[model samples]
Target: MEKITSNQNSRVKDWKRMQTKKGRVKSGQYVIEGWHIVDEAIRHRQTIKELMVVDESYLGALPVDDTTQVFIITPEIAKHISSTETPQGVFAVLDTQDYHEKIPDELQGAWLLLDNIQDPGNIGTMVRTADAAGLDGIVFGKGSADIYNPKVVRSMQGSQFHMKLFTGDILDWMAAFQNAGIKTYGTELNDQAVSYDTVKPTSQFALVMGNEGNGVDPEILEKTDQNLYIPMKGEAESLNVAVATGILLFKFVK
Candidate 1:
């Protein structure tokens, strides 16, 4: 095992860079902190390139093989790499999985499509909800938050490992679903939209959730087979994107 005590170490600087979208893209890797997520990565058989912990004692029984490099980082190094108030003292660097090229020839099953969502928390919540709702996968459209964002990864609570995630044009996905004989629903409140409960839940469909301030893109909604709205009886004008997603996803699944 290697030891790194200096925050200025060349490798430490590389790990810090993983915190940003551009850096993650350039390196083709991202860093995940905390034991739960790390364990999830291991159990899910993700390609873990390296493990960094403050103490050797914290390395108890991890299933990493000899191919995975282990580094003993000082608490200062942990703080340098962590984004939270208190560092979990455990971190793992994983190669980013590129699903763009791996998209199935024929897309099937329920999928959650995010359109221009910007909040890491909201993105993470919807992902966890989709996983809990047993959706086949999630497609991150062009303007959605970065899935590998550290905050998003932590907020997902490891549910990311349980589901397929993809990135692509929402319109393309809509077309693919159409070709597969699956319907696409966009969340909106236009005159042509109907209440969400009006539609019957099915085994396969695509649900699009829009931006926090703006709803689904007009063009995207125009392409959807139907548009849905959640009726509100209370004075509340709207639901948080994440909360609304959970409600709609559960309704769409059998």
Candidate 2:
């Protein structure tokens, strides 16, 4: 393994760049910090390119093969590349999964479609919830938060490795679902929308969650076969997008 002590090192600079979306896109890679997420990446067979740790002690008994580069980085360097307030001193660089050019020949099972949901924490929570609910996949629609964002990844708590994730236009996915004879449900509170519990649960369907503030796009809602609204008995005006997603996903799964 190689040792890197300087924060100015070119490789160190490259890892730091991965904290941004542009850098991730440019290099086709992203950095994940914390031992649990790194271990999840390893166990899930993600294409890991490099692993960096502040101490050699972290190297023993790792499942990585010889091809993955290992580095001993100083704690200072770990902090420089870390997205958290307290650096974990462990990091992994992984190649981003490119699903843009490939669409599955058949769309099956339940899917969650995110329409312009921008909160990293919400996105992450929804993803984790989807995984827990045993959804087949999630489509990150246009205007949604970047899946590889550091904050989003951390919030996901490694659940991303457990399910399929895609990126594309929301309308296109709706069209595809229509072609596949799968019903797409949009969340909204306007007239013509029904209580979420009124719909029968099924193995194959898509649920669309919208922006935190504005809700689903009007055009997208119009395209969905049905629009659903959670009936709240309390005084709360609205539910957090992520919280609403969990309730709906579990309901649909049941």
Candidate 2 lDDT: 0.91
**After aligning candidate 1 to the native by TM-score, how far in Å is the CA of 56 from where it should be?**
1.1
lDDT of each: 0.91, 0.91
Q: Write the per-residue lDDT of candidate 1 for residues 1-254, one digit (tens) a residue.
A: 99999988999999999999999999999999998999999999888899999999888857797899999999999999998989989999998887463457978999999999999989999999999999998999988889899999999988878888899899988999999999999998768999999888899999999999999999999999999999999999999999999999888898
**Candidate 1, lDDT over the whole model:** 0.91
Residue 33, candidate 2: how far off, in angstroms? 1.0
lDDT of 2 by residue, 74-186 (tens): 98998899999898888999888885545578988999999999999999999999999999999998898899999889989888788888999889899989999999999
